[model samples]
Target: MAKKETVWRGLIAACGLFLILLTVSIGVFLCYKGLGTFTLYKHSVWEFLFSSNWNPADDFQGGGQVGAAIFIVGSVSICLLALLIATPFSLAAAIFMAVISPRVSNRLLQPAVEIFVGIPSVVYGWVGLTVLVPLIQKIFNLQYGYSVLAGGIVLAVMIFPTITSVSADSIRNIPLQYQEAAYGLGSTRWQVIRRVLVPAARPGILTGVILGLARAFGEALAVAMVIGKMKAFPTGILSPTNNLTAAIASDMGGAADGGEYNIALWTMALLLLVISFAFILIVRKISSKGVRER
Candidate 1:
């Protein structure tokens, strides 16, 4: 029995170590390849990051004019919009499931949400392309509906399930004693939920929001289909835009391997890695603060 326990413990430790090694390996590779862009192409790192122009054709003859500022802005703006649209709905659904109507949630809403999660991202893109695009265009009286707003709407729908599921689980896990104590103090259900449950579950809810943000930031195909791949800084939510992930997805295949164009894509990938790492660090800090408060 002791031997079996030892084996299981070793297996778990190995798995954890492997994951850490894999993440570190990926970060190292991105750093190496991304820095190669500046060295191999003689491109200014400042220009590559700050300039809005992204014409790779100039780099073919050693001009090195590639830039990603517009893409970065697009990525941030779309993700912010998606979060704004998704948060209220997700929190409301979570509250309903874990607080107001557990029976309904268990019987129907949770299953429906689970099924929504299984649906492919491409399907969401297609739906946006076929349905939401025309609707937006008609409503806004635009020549086309492919814009940052469309991308944000599609991303919101795609990430809604993740945020809702995680938040609901967090709320459900709050101790019954807290709820009973609130009630004993003559608090109503809404009061207890708003004051006690939400405050207690805030850390977990923030985790879910961060996960949703990560998903929104990394998504490519769905966003690409809806957001017209304009390489300029977006003027507004209704303006056409392109994100870093979409730029990589749409342009990488055509770029010459080991060429300046390919190297620029690697640089964009590095930026994505850095952004995701920052988000993880933020989560860690918030979690630690929550633990201290508890």
Candidate 2:
């Protein structure tokens, strides 16, 4: 028994160490490759981060003007919009599934949602391209439908299952005694949910939201298809734009190995890594606050 226990513990420890090592390795690699762009091209990090001009044409063969401000803004806008669209629906679904309609949730709704998760991103993109894009254009009387709005809508659908699943799990984990206490205090079901359940599950819900945001930020294929891939600052939600992930996907292949363009792509990847880390930190902070409140 001791030997088996020791083996299992070692295996778990090894897995944890491997994950840590992998994360550190990726961060180091991105920093090295990303910083190389500034050194090789003599471009200021400030310009790369703040400037909207992303003209890699001149730098195709060598170092040229490369700025990612527009892509960064577009990425932020799309993610914000997606969260706005998804959060309310996801929360409602979670509440219904965990509190109001467990039988239906288990028998039908969860399976339906799982099906959505199983569908390929490319299929979602294609549907957006063929259906949502044209509908948006026609309704809004725009020349093109491929815009930030389209991307946000598509991304909302993609992250819906993630947010809903996590939130449902969080709500379901709430102690039954909490609900009974609320009822004893003359609280109704809705009131109990609003005051007791939601507050208790807040940390987990926030974690789910952040995870969904990460998915929205990192998504490449689906957003790329509907966002028009324009290398400019988004003037409005209706405007066509590009994102960091899309820019990397579309431009990386054309860049020669060890070239300025390649390095610029690496820099975008580094920015993505930074954004992901920030989200993780935010999750930790929320978790800590929840513990303190308890």
Writing each residue's lDDT as its tens digit, candidate 1 over 161-196 gives: 999998999899889999999999999999998999
Q: After superposition, how far is residue 224 of candidate 1 from its true place, in Å?
A: 0.2
- Itemize residue pairs with steric clashes in candidate 1: none
lDDT string, candidate 2, 51-76, tens digits: 98777543535557788899999999
Those runs of model 1 whose alpha carbons end farther than 4 Å from true positions after fitting are 57-61
Q: What is the TM-score of each candidate against the true structure?
A: 0.95, 0.95
Please state the error at residue 142 of candidate 1 in Å. Answer: 0.6
| lDDT computed for candidate 1 | 0.91
List of clashing residue pairs for candidate 2: none
